[model samples]
Target: MSSSPQTGSEPVTAPSTTSLTLAIIVSCELMLMLDGTITNVALPMIGDGLGFTPAGLSWVTNAFLLAFGGLLLLGGRAGDILGRRRVFLVGIGLFTAASLLAGLAQTPWQLVVARAAQGAGAALAGPSTLALLTTSFTGEHRTKALGVYSSVTASAMTLGLILGGVITTLASWRWVLLINVPIGVLVLLLAPRHVAESPRHGGRFDLAGALTSAIGVVAVVYALVRTADHGWADPTTLVTLVAGAALLAGFVLVERRAAQPIMPLRLLAERTRAVGFAIMLLVPMVTMSFQFLVIQFLQLVLDLSPLQAGLAFLPMAAGLLVTSRTANGLLGRFGTKPTAAAGLLLLTAAAAWSATISTATTYLGGILGPMLLIGLALGLVIVPINVAIMSTVDPQDAGAASGVLQTTMMTGAALGIAVLSAIYAATVGSTSAVLVGDDAVALGMRHGFVASTVIAALALAVTLAGYAVRERQSSHTK
Candidate 1:
């Protein structure tokens, strides 16, 4: 096995100014996250314009995901080896060029290729964004910065949905991809002047580790996605699942032997950070599944248009915006453990309430309350969880740590959607049979929400257990 890097931790360089730097990094992150789901609202239009078969059209989204999810670890390690600023700018430049190509694409395949390129660019940039945030800001300022960053991350999905609906309806589906071009260009121009360069470590790339981990995660995600579409027993799904497991096993062995491991195992050893990662993974799982089910309920049961359905989520977005601004202060006063636990309790309560929804439920009654609660809960949860994760990480490994966190969030959301889709199918019965009526759709959504409640409850239980453990250890120290 290769040894850990012998380099001393880099001293935090006090930036002369943080406003411009924070804006540039946060904007880039917002763009990357927005792309993750913005295409969803415009899928029908895209399929129509590109002449895609129903099944084939999904690749337009999956291509980006596979590339982005698979390459994230490598991207983080690259930032550590190369300068963060250099890699960040290169990624932005590539993303902007790809966005232009995607907007101009006439063929389905061309758009798919462009989307994948954008994903690769995003993978390269995403970790650097978090790394920069952690490196640039320290103490109370860092906490506040992370709070705003978390808010942006939490809101980006909804914002993307809202933007996708408006843009697709008012203009064309192509503009969803086109919009990034200008934003990317602006960031690229500003990044050089504002963002500081991170110190480069001397090491060879962990090529084997990267290849195996990327392929493994991609295969796993592919299997989950297919299982959601097809049944769990599909031969293709089974084969891919097994292949993914084997590749991931190989990746572990490779990492143990590599001179400079891309993801150091030591990061997971700390109890607080470990809890942070677990919550990051599970919390998004709950939120993503909620979004998937609620959107279906709005569209299928309520017979709302894409635009209307998108607009329905605005209350939650507003609540999130308001609370995220003050999350750092809450975290400072209450601490992450208490703050996070309170948030999970609220989330659990909201999910439990959402489970009672039916065809008779009204937006103002059942839906709006849960949406607002979820927004407030998420605002409280995300910032502290982020603070907990990055609080103890060594500056030298910031890129890798950020990569791991991002990977957890993406993989969690994907898995949550897949599992929840399966639950919805099972609850409604017959995956192949389309839902016959509003009642059927409503019942299915209720079942999905019930399942989501289970997930939130589990997350809360884990949080409590982590607290108990911390208490016992503290007593021992005394």
Candidate 2:
């Protein structure tokens, strides 16, 4: 919350000097990133194991996401106020403890509660990872380090699917949650030896901005979820949506007035950052919906086992790995703006292809094609947008700026999945019976996928328009 120097917002000009150290830090970061999506594939197993109702099971993901997204600013502020090294260890500690609790949960409620705690831990640790990177290296070295971070982030979704599939099939769903404990322990133990602390700054935390933003995101996401259950026309849904919008607006006002703002209004007002984050949000909205919808298609419609379904997503992981590695070089040649636009276009095309898929579609025909294209598009889009957002912000505010960048994507994906799930459910029929019955839901699921393509297409327009503006701005500067 505090815009202090000691919170480690100073830029990293020499990550090369500490390359080995940063490798360890990046591993720590990858662990956190892996946790975000790893549990996604394991959701079905966890629900069955805990005897959770369909609606009840959504909380396993939503609870963790809401807490993680809502509290990210607080986490970034903690890094600023508490000192990055101290806060990093604290976050690692909290997340590790929560992982153990989640692993041990015997009931559905217990699991949801534990997941939320784990989210709290994640929120704290996640921003610290970026802040640590900011202080760990500098200059062109910083760019390279960010590229490394970006690739890890790019592959996170697919990595989670692969890991969850193998682990859940080979071991138990609990192992998916339990996996974090060992990673966290390693990070907590090694963080101090490799990473140097940023010099401290003086200020109070932006408590007001943090609270309103968190509540606002919760309210909005809740409203989206309500739309699924009650339909979009329901009074409760409308009221929650209105309330969330109002609270988020108030959050803006609060940040404008606060001496130490968690999110700087000025940064958000930038055309590049705003557009970039919007594109960032939309990409996940498309992909996460694909995950929720398609996974069902795989298991129920295609009759694949959890392991098979998980393994089926391997192409996505492979595609991301190949494309993400070349992204920086692509960006260097094409420029950040054009590269982002191109990526969005590719993503929209992938969604278009994905929309054509159905329960009757073969793994090769329907699933693998979209998964690979989507993965490649993600590798292209995520890195540049993330780099743009973080790079545009003032170095002193990197923690808050990066926190918002990460939070928007996570919240959007979570809320996006919830809304998409409702759409699939209402249109396709209840998921429970589809598994046992004649599978009448395939038609509806196909329609849902097609409709989601509209979102990606719209995002493409936004990306194109934004980049055009950037091009004009560059021309003017010249």
Q: Which runs of model 1 end up more than 4 angstroms from their true locations? A: 1-16, 44-62, 104-113, 422-440, 469-478
TM-score of 1: 0.87
Query: What lDDT is reached at residue 409 by model 1?
Result: 81
The TM-score leader among the candidates is 2
Residue 441 lDDT in candidate 2:
52
Evaluate all candidate structures by whole-model CA lDDT and list the values in order. 0.77, 0.76
Query: Each model's TM-score?
Result: 0.87, 0.91
Worst 10 residues of 1 by lDDT: 469-478
Q: Which ten contiguous residues of candidate 2 have the minimum total lDDT?
A: 469-478
Q: How well does candidate 1 score on lDDT at residue 257?
A: 81
List runs of model 2 lying over 4 Å from the truth: 1-17, 428-441, 469-478
List per-candidate RMSD values in Å.
4.9, 3.6
